[model samples]
Target: WLRGTRKDPPTLDETIAHENKRQQLEKKPINMLPTSYGRDAAQGGTGKCSA
Candidate 1:
């Protein structure tokens, strides 16, 4: 159960779900931030925002 040996991080769906839940719990608009930058993005693995 070590950090390196553990499973990969949550999928995009899970991340989005968690973000949505957090937003709802706080009762405020969640100012979205980029999940990654440059060529190392994780936003669906596209690494670029598309509107």
Candidate 2:
């Protein structure tokens, strides 16, 4: 039968470590608007306008 032949998967600790590494790899820095944009409306290009 396949039951005995199949090996056990990763342990809890191993699984957690893998997930943590994956999250770190997927993380990225957030982009914020420059303060200068607040002073000049023309400098800040109009983003997607809805009707």
Candidate 3:
């Protein structure tokens, strides 16, 4: 099962720190503006064209 290659899981402190960081992220607003990707004029990902 490749258990020897698997790294140890995060400790309690590590997991708490991770959760706190995630909570901080959840409090922030995500920039959903389409200034790239599915709205790039050059790339033509305006949702009308196929990938």
Winner by TM-score: 3
- Can you tell me which runs of candidate 1 are displaced by over 4 Å? 1-6, 28-51
Candidate 3 per-residue lDDT, tens place, 19-51, comes to 575456446556744454334445432232221
Q: Please, what are the lDDT tens digits per residue for candidate 1 over residues 1-51?
A: 113454888678866866675455346335633332312332333322221
lDDT of 2 by residue, 4-27 (tens): 354877578756765575455346
Clashing pairs in 1: none
- State how far residue 16 of model 1 sits from its true place (Å): 0.1
Ranking by lDDT: 3, 1, 2
Sort by TM-score, top down from the best:
3, 1, 2
Model 3, position 6, has a per-residue lDDT of 47
Q: Cα RMSDs of all predictions?
A: 10.1, 18.6, 13.1
Q: Count the backbone clashes (under 3 Å) in each candidate.
A: 0, 0, 0
TM-score of 3: 0.44
Q: Residue 16 of candidate 1: its Cα lDDT?
A: 82
Global lDDT of each model? 0.43, 0.41, 0.47
TM of each candidate vs. truth: 0.40, 0.40, 0.44
